[model samples]
Target: MKKYLVLLVVPMLFALGCKEKKTETQPDQIMVTEKPKLPETVLDSLKNHPPEGMVWIPGGEFMQGAVPQDKQAMDHEKPQHPVKVDGFFMDITEVTNAEFAKFVKETGYVTVAERAIDWEEMKKQLPEGTQKPADSILQPGSLRFKKTKSSVPNLYDFSQWWEWSIGTNWKHPQGPDSNLDGKENFPVVHVCYEDALAYCQWANRRLPTEAEWEYAARGKQKNTIYFWGDDRSKLAQEANTWEGEFPVYNTKVDGFEGTAPVKSYPSNGFGLYDMAGNVWEFTQDWYNVDYYKELAAKNTIAMNPQGASQAYNPQNPYLQEKIIKGGSFLCSDSYCSSFRVSARMGTSPDSSAEHVGFRTVADPEMIME
Candidate 1:
């Protein structure tokens, strides 16, 4: 069960065509742009020199879904399939708060979390006679995790720990009073898909397609439960997932109660850090629960699968979602065991949360002369 309350509000805002402005004086306005394509010459230079915090992932075919015997696997991750992905350069670590701050400071980008909700737009998602939420409740904010008082048997009800905290955004992750003081190196949270896209635009990069994200996360490891391999003992040493009971308490076995600094953990085979945990990263693909089945039905290796053209989740039919790869620090064996390389999740493209952030990718096509 993904959070739906936030999702319900996201599509409405997007439907209204509200854009974030990108001028130095107007930091609160939305800015929108078409996806960028890099020039061949620039791409060639990138291949040789590579970007400062990136690793080259060689192109290849690999198992792209849940392993045959993964009991924890969900139906959406099943029917393992082969996917072929081209080589590309991927961020070595999740984009840090410091990095996102630089983009915001330079571009004056206003993240979705910072914009006030439009009641008129929101009403479109409701029934004919439904009443609107109070103006105060519609204030600009983002979802943040709040530890539950006790263990929750129904892990599906994520509302137990996730709350829409008013005034919560990238600058104030927890609330209005909280700031990114010493956590500059921590992966920036409370960023929606648009915010990530804006950052990518500023950096001259793009979000990885779902196939690329999985391929890079696998890091050349064939059919392993995790990027490091199938060993559970190594999880604590290699990632920042929840160690104790989820929602209620965290044992901090991985030495992090919330998010650890980027690269605090060991890197995967391709030298990518925090690939398993830290934050759920956004991908450039619309999510469809049965998309894998559709691909498997093809019976041939999917050549650079770009993901579904439209989003669909049977559980929440109205909300549009995009595929988000990797799990977050909140992942727990008892709850969301999504740290596994093949695990998949979806959320509204305009929904931002404390457990979500993203990294960028540069495709090989860009370098092809």
Candidate 2:
């Protein structure tokens, strides 16, 4: 079987509102119940605008996940259902190389891709008696995508173009030979979930919950396909996505072959940029193909659903994966049609790629502080 890894890695390396009602009974009785004072946190949220580089997403109900009519919708995205999320602040764009560098500088943090592999941990997910790869192969590195010479029918054989390159990390996204010298504004790729979480902690923000992410990406629009609208034509002008055949060819019609600079394209209705294509973003949710089914079965709006309590991918049950939202520049109509607002994907928490990155979200309470 051509593992999903190939199709997955080949890409590059690879809000709420409230209303009040009047009571009918006590016109003459003059009954007055103090409207619950907006909590200080809520008041602070309303009084103060979102922090620099963040946008406030008003809370509300929306249909989250692939619509029934979307031909590109996958099994995991099925049974589109309603989800309610509270208002929160989200980064205006993906964390950039410069921003991540600053975090590393301030905290002396090393990304998972830059750290040596743990053989003990690796063996846990493998069958018994499986021998460890050579120490050279276990060195710190990440997956990087290389273009194929010609189009191939099978996009899943990611090994064809993805190399487990040594010295490839967020700072050197392409490989050991590459550097971010002039690409500080580009989204920082090759960051694992733990790396992203560490940055979030230093920044005092957190990953957006899957529901919060979908709700914000919808941008208060009702059941739209792409973040801008249902029109695919807008993608060429509004988002950075593959313009021609993916993997083998890219026309760069969108003015970018890989990741584009932050805010290179227009912002969505919520004033958030690159929510469609650019790079896939990490979400505070575990991967579970049937998670949506479980939520849909509730037959009621899921309020701030935190996602599956644990990671589960039936196809790769031993590997724990987390949900990744948005799509990357490698996303094209021909393959990985994940730029759709409701499209979803997942990968192991420890995995990193040239086409994956993340942004942060802050709760009202955090923002208040």
Candidate 3:
């Protein structure tokens, strides 16, 4: 979904949303296997009880990055390497609207989408010689999926599905007209990386590092495609994603057309919900397309690997991005099949979109401090 949450520092401000960078890679059907159960943990006798609504994930070493058999794997996901992480507590599900509202109520924090766009600051992330747009286009807004009437020219143009809508934010997911009326239980969307970090600061929690996110997503199932193992057959019934033609119609086979409520599906081996699909969860890693290769070259297990030191996206070198794990409702086999555990994307630290959200984690040491 790297492109699904794509943040193009477009000279055209009217357009928001991302288009997957076209790839020759094809996804062949993978082998089927049973979803694993959570391994026994020492939580029962531990003094560090998981923070409320959080689960303690006892860390262990595992082969990180994509396996060769993952036909859907991208260049960035390749060159499997070794990694280990410290055990920590993670949010059982993506941060829900209700939970985020509590943060907003207490901190009175306004998300990036709610703020007026600044041309002076925005141009810094754009290409030189790019003309500044009109005042109306610089108003508060966020990206929302706008379904096409029928198949478009091709999927390469992400603008076909993602639309930059004014008055869109966490409170108003779709646009100014939409509200969180009955959707408080749904995972909060239209939250950018900066917005997520703000919430983390307020809550005294932090976003999981890229290594931790992938490790927890695996749920003890190593060398497998998803947290539920490599059973691609059961993916539709297990994760909330587009069941029909993407950017056009959704069959709603997953019981919801858009974002489904948390716990709507079975949890992963670590008792984590929506680890596969829902909304893209932000991680602490800076975006580096070759970070995996760099780690693999070490020939030694990366202990608590904190992402790349600097942000780099050859596609969009102007804007800085952070790693985003888990695919969103827009994900599909025909499109960006990023629901797999290893699937990762990068989006602007300041951009917000409908299909993007985040969760939080806490290091055990932080709790003691």
TM-score of every model versus the real structure = 0.87, 0.88, 0.88
Give the per-residue lDDT of model 3 (tens digit) for 164-227.
7779889988789889999989999988888898999988899998888999998888889888
Query: Which RMSD values do the candidates have, in order?
Result: 7.6, 10.5, 7.6
Question: Scored by CA lDDT, what does every candidate get?
Answer: 0.80, 0.79, 0.79
On TM-score, the stronger of 1 and 2 is: 2
How much is the lDDT of residue 84 in candidate 1?
75
Off by over 4 Å in 1: 1-46, 126-130, 364-369
Supply the global lDDT for candidate 3: 0.79
Error of 3 at 333 (Å): 0.8
**Model 1 lDDT tens row, 1-369:** 122443333334223433322112112111122234567677567677876888788778898888876678889997888877767889999999999999999999998889877767755644344455556667788888999898788886666687778899999998999999999999999999989999988888899988889988887788889998888899899999999888888989899998999989888889999989889999977777867888888788787777775566766555567889899999999988989999889887777899999999876554343
Ranking by TM-score: 3, 2, 1
Model 3 off-target regions past 4 Å?
A: 1-48
Deviation in Å, model 3, residue 73 alpha carbon: 0.8
Which candidate number would show the highest lDDT if scored against the true structure? 1
Per-residue CA lDDT of model 2 for 1-369, tens digit only, reads 111222233223120121222212112211112223458676665646668999888778888888765788888987888777777889999999999999999999999888877778766654345455667667788878888898878876557667777899998888889899999999999999999999999999999988889888887677778877788778889888889876888999999998999999888888899998899999978777777888888788777777776565655544567899999998988778889988888787788888899999987677656
